[model samples]
Target chain A: MIIANTLADGFVVFLTEAHSWTNDITKGAVAETDEQAESLLTAAKQAEQTNVVIDPYLIPINIEDGLRKPTEYREYIRATGPTVPIPS
Target chain B: MYRYDEFDARLVTERVEQFRRQAQRRLSGELTEDQFKPLRLMNGLYLQLHAYMMRINIPYGALSSKQMRQLAHIARTYDKGYGHFTTRQNIQYNWIQLKNVPDALADLAAVEMHGIQSSGNCIRNTTSDQYAGVARDELEDPRVYCEIIRQWSTLHPEFSFLPRKFKIAVTGSPNDRAAVKLHDIGLRMHQNEQGKTGFEVIVGGGQGRTPFVGKTIRDWLAPEHLLSYLEAILRVYNLDGRRDNKYKARIKILVHQIGTDEFRRLVDTEWQQIKDGALNLPQSEIDRINAYFTPPAYAQIDDETESLNEQRTQNPAFDAWVQANLAEHKVSGYSIVNISLKSPKLPPGDVTAVQMDALADLADEYSFSELRVNHRQNLVLADVPQKDLLSLWTKLIELDLATPNIGLISDIIACPGLDYCALANARSIPLAQEIHQRFQDIDKVHDIGELTINISGCMNACGHHHVGHIGILGVDKRGKEFYQFTLGGSSDQNASLGDRTGKGFPADEAVNAVEKILNTYIMVRNDGERFLETYRRVGMKPFKEALYGSA
Candidate 1:
């Protein structure tokens, strides 16, 4: 599991294969199988390896194109949609 | 004490006009908050939690009575009739309006002061001992070199946009009152075996998430090469210090990651390139700056022992203050008087406009129209006569500025915290106030003896809680305030970061926990042992057990 910390807005998100989680227990998604969740965890770890922690307040966010942007305003990012769109 | 040359004067005047236009543009909706944020910060105006804050520079912590009175005027007219002096020896007005800041800068400039280089990523204020020139043990005045650095660093075109903020502290005496070891560049004046004055340069000392005591980079750097050497270090930092990650951007991390030897080699290589450039100090220029700080024409008088003794016998309150707050001056019959800003009811370093004017009058009457803003957030009249001590004490008493808490627990150093700081997670002033009230007993504080209790509202460590004898850090736990205590930090010759004791305490119980820690120290301390000494001898085991109960 990887946690993303945000500053301008408060709260950290825990990311797992099936879904993103906030506040530890609040789940965001459900994968069809546990194997898919494991692959997601591996991808998150790989993303974390390349990410740079600029301000401690920012959290690493993963885009569908396999790039990560550290940002505090996740809502703005969500509104704009990902730079790399996911496969429909 | 650096007199502004025409170039310096013109630069500040132009800066003031620029900021005036920026403010006007922001008000007229020509500039958005995103556009104006960096511009305002470049000019030392910050939008904090409650109001706009303007930081005014006191270069090398030195101030004249005229400059101080101008500060008083600003406090009276523009702010909430008060100002807070910071650990960097700069004064901050917390309630300033955006419209009023340009005028505030202009007011500051009239007294040969400004807020330039006070914020932003450029080199900030160069601080030094408040007793720089007047201290008995000083090799030479550190302010001369500080002024030299200030002139060179102010808006140096190439080095303005560094990775992180840089701080430099200089001290002339071996006592290290300026806390040089905790600065990005710590310059200490020393006389080598040959009896020549030079600086012992230390680099990479800083506090934050990662606190490291600076390592000595040069054993003896000649006074003439001060600017060249500093420029080399700054240039190296600007190019190599991490810009990718702000957390790893301070020169401290650079020094740590590259290792001191490599960092030193880089600086040496860079210095060789710029050694004899325009930055090299000319002998005539050094002498000119030194002349402004020449010793006053002091009259030879006896130590005024009889009068001092008489006053001590008659007035115990004045006697206690004298013992705690006064320092021996280099001149006979003269002493340095600390006008305490740590009254119980007031914020730790807050001084009202009326009090500032009174202090200005006192400085003129007592100390050759000069004053100093100390890093510990107190004001100093550096040349008060021993005979005039009683009169000054009486006046200070009337003004409610005569708290005899210098170097004591009540003389706590605290940041504005969540009460006023935008970055703060919890409040620090209320905790400081609570601790001050808890240890209000003068005799008890005297018995506790020479403790520095520093509190920071956040991990930025502006209050330097990491180096406090008893450091209190405020953290937010589920939206409620929690306090973490650390023990045995000292910034003097034996510089050491404090050790965390254990689990954090809630806000209401922190004062009692501190009381327990002090009580334990009092019980375990040997004779003549200070608080840091006892904490060092027994370690935090005894303190933790005392505060949290034996387990």
Candidate 2:
């Protein structure tokens, strides 16, 4: 799965729904194969041109119970956001 | 306290205008990321893990209450209502909008501040002793020289691009609070045989993947020739420093490759040309900048040490705070109050907008209208009167900042880690929070005594883990978070690097590993001995044995 932060305000973004960036990963497509992941990255690279998200890249992940999750702890933190509140 | 002149004002305004245009261009796709990266970096706007992190340079870590209020305003208006004070004496807003940066910088400029040259491959904001003028042990106020260097290095046409970013730190006292020895260029003020103040010029000291304590390039450089000498060193570095690899681009690599003696010869050769040339700082300009940093109008008040002692005896919390946080001021009646940003739960160095406003108010009411940002990511109310210590402590308590864990084990130094930084390999903040939580009792923490536990998300050393007595560097093993510990590091006058523990602990065992080391210290330490002192005396054998459990 390709995960990134939006350039405008820095929220979590996932490549979802035909290569569009969205916050919801459940609605997103996961790479079924390495070839598909490569193709997804090629499609996602265009998001930088739109200047919406910066440095989009693939991460190790596991999909279970129809929900996607990052395989790594750092990726999990980035995907879910900081454990602490934003302090309003 | 050095107010911007008309030229400075004009320069800041023009830079803001230019960055505004560049921001617009980037948004509209007129500029690509490759073209726009340097421009944005020069303005201190960075794309971090979650958002755009805008680093605001607080020159010499000096800020007036008005400037602090402006920072609070910017945090409230443009960012996530708080800012993280960095280890380099700057505050970073982690959640900034790319479009809002120009406006935020415009607000900063209204307070005579700009982010120029803060993040680019240029000389960054010249950091110095937080208690520059007021330290009892100071030979000179390093801020005067800091301002001099700031003016000399700011927007220098020749140094706009270099091999990599350069950092300089200066100190005026024998007690090295500024960690001057761990910078690209470090200047330590001292008196020569004739009782004239100059600097012991040290170069090539840095902490990163390759860590080295700066070597003394010049034993004594005359005060008048400061700028010329610095320009000479930089000129040599600019021409000769490596550029082939980004990892090896720092001037430290150059100094290491050529050796300090050869590097000194080159700097000296360059210096002879500019020694009496236009770069020689004029006496009037030096005096003009120095005048801004003279001792504030101190009242004829007694030290009141007896009463402060009495108050400490009465209130245990205040006493713990007084013991840990307060430093003796040059003026007898005043005390340097170090406000700890390392609360037990929150991330170290994070301060909220409301807290900033409150600190500004505290500065105005208790201390003078000035508060200093220490390079340890704490704030200093430098001139608080001895009599007002209790009241200040009370106020801090109300603000949830009176943790009284200043030099204690709980007062951790951790970077933003994977939570915020794009470059981090593993999580640092969560590890730090775990450590802080593990060691919570103030009495127990105080008994542990004066252990600097620094954690960096990666080997970049943003958390200054290289100099920590107990340094923790987070690492990744097959996408799993692990931590590596180091021992016997000190950033004081006796600057030294830490030695790695030879093993890595998975995230679950990281805090337990630290606990084992600390337990070993408690077991083997002499009376009133700090962790570093014990580690230095005994060497690492016992601690290694404790962690790894024998051969």
Candidate 3:
């Protein structure tokens, strides 16, 4: 999975299958193999150069119960929101 | 309340315009993220987990009523209607959009405040005791020297890019409520043999990865030589401090590598060149800064002891608040009222825009239209009249700001952990909320008596966990959230780092471990001993036994 923060607002964004950024992690494109992940990251870097996103990186994912999930807790947090409630 | 002169106002205004242009360039794709990151950070703008976070400095923890109201307006207009007050006496907005930041900076500049020097590799905002001018025990107001240091360090061309960020703290009282021993350089004011006031210079103290209790470099330094002495120390550090590794770049690491005596010798050698140079503070300049902090006009009135006792006998709730929150003021009819933002219902330092506005109004009515932010993440009305104690308490209760847990178990210092900060390994605020929930009973908390529990999301120790009586540091163990506990720390005049207990606990079990430790303290405490005193007397053996079942 390729993830980055949008440049304008610095909000979390994920690369979709159409090579565009989406705010929802569930709708993000997933790569099955290392080569696919590398290619996806390379495409994301082009978007970065075009001033769409910043610090694009690959986050490993696991398919659990027919849903994709982030492997690291940090990525999981970034994908979802904060584990605690924030002021409304 | 140091009003900005023309130079100060011009500097801040120009900086805001510069930031506006930089932000525009970034938005218009003229500058890349790499180029904009440093520029934004120099203005105290950071991209955290969720959104852009902005940290605004509150010089010497002091804020006038107008400034406080302006902050409230900023929170309501530009942010998510709230702000988080940090342990450095600064306020952070966790959800600021990058596009709105320039306008926010302009708003702050209108009130003589900005985020400059609040971050970056420069001398950050110099913190002083929250009870600076009002404390009965202080020799003189430290904010005078704080403002002087602020003027000297802001945009200082020579020391702007040091090994890393530098922090200085000053305290005028011998009791050391400002946590001076945990700063990069600590200035403790006292009288010499001739009864002339000066500062005791302590160098290279900090609280991050490698914590060190500051060592005294000079027994007594005359007030006139303060800026020159500081320049000499900064010059030495900039010349020899390590820059290869970011972790080892702090002055504390340099002071530790080379012995304190050697560091002092180097500073002295540098001081010989610049001691009487342009950096030396003239008496007239000192007097001019001192005049800004002259005591407010106090009316001639008797102490309200008899009336206070009558009210105390009638109202136990007010009495409890009076006992826990009020500090002795130098003036007979006055009291220092601490407003606790550490209610179990909210995060430790989080304050809503509504609360800020109401508190500012209360300050205008009760105090002298002035409020202060403490390093403990609480607010202070420095000059409340004793006669108005009941009325003030009544208003605070209505506003949900009357938590009587100052210096008690429920008063926890917590950093914005993984929930907001990108550097965090585990969530700190939720754990703080958990501990607070267990200890929110006022009677039970008062019985614990003067215990400090500081929580940091990671080893960065921004929450001052190293000096907590019971410190909890959140760690990621095998992809799970775990917490490590430290015991027997104090950040007062006799400051020391906490010693780690045997092993770490899971998030849920950490709270139980804290309970066990406190239960042991309650079981073994002497008649008048505090939690720290009992732990110091008995050592960590009893606590280790209770937590790990006598293994």
**Best model number under TM-score:** 3
lDDT of 1 by residue, B1-551 (tens): 56788998899999999999987887666675667778988888876643567888889878888988999899888887888899999999876878778888998888888988788898999999999999998889998888888888899898889999999999999998999999999999998889999999999999987999999999999888999999899999999999999889999999999999999999999999999888888889999989878887787887999989999999999999999999989889999898888888788888888888988899889889888989899989999889999999999999998999899899999998877676876778888888898887877989999999999988999888999999999887875778999998989878999999988899899999999999999999999899999988999888888987787
Best by DockQ: 3
Per-residue lDDT of model 3, residues B17-68, tens digit only: 9999999999989998889989999999999987789999999899998999
| lDDT (Cα, tens digit) per residue for candidate 2, span B1-551 | 78999999999999999999998998888888889889999999888777788998999999999999999999999987999999989999988888888899999999999888879789999999998999999988999999989998999988988888999999999999999999999999999999988899999999999999999999999878998898888899899998889899999999999999999999999998989888877779889999988788999898998998999999988898999998889998999999999886568899989999999999999988999998888889999999998998999998988878777787788889888898999888888888888988877887888899999989899999999999999888887888999998888899999988878999999999999999999999999898998998898899999989898
What is the C-alpha lDDT profile of model 3 across A9-60, one tens digit per residue?
A: 7789999989999988889999988898989999999999988888899999
Worst 10 residues of 2 chain B by lDDT: B403-412
Winner by TM-score between candidate 3 and candidate 1: 3
- Model 3: CA > 4 A from native: A62-68
- CA deviation > 4 Å runs, candidate 2: A33-39
Candidate ranking under DockQ, highest first, comes to: 3, 2, 1
Candidate with best lDDT: 3
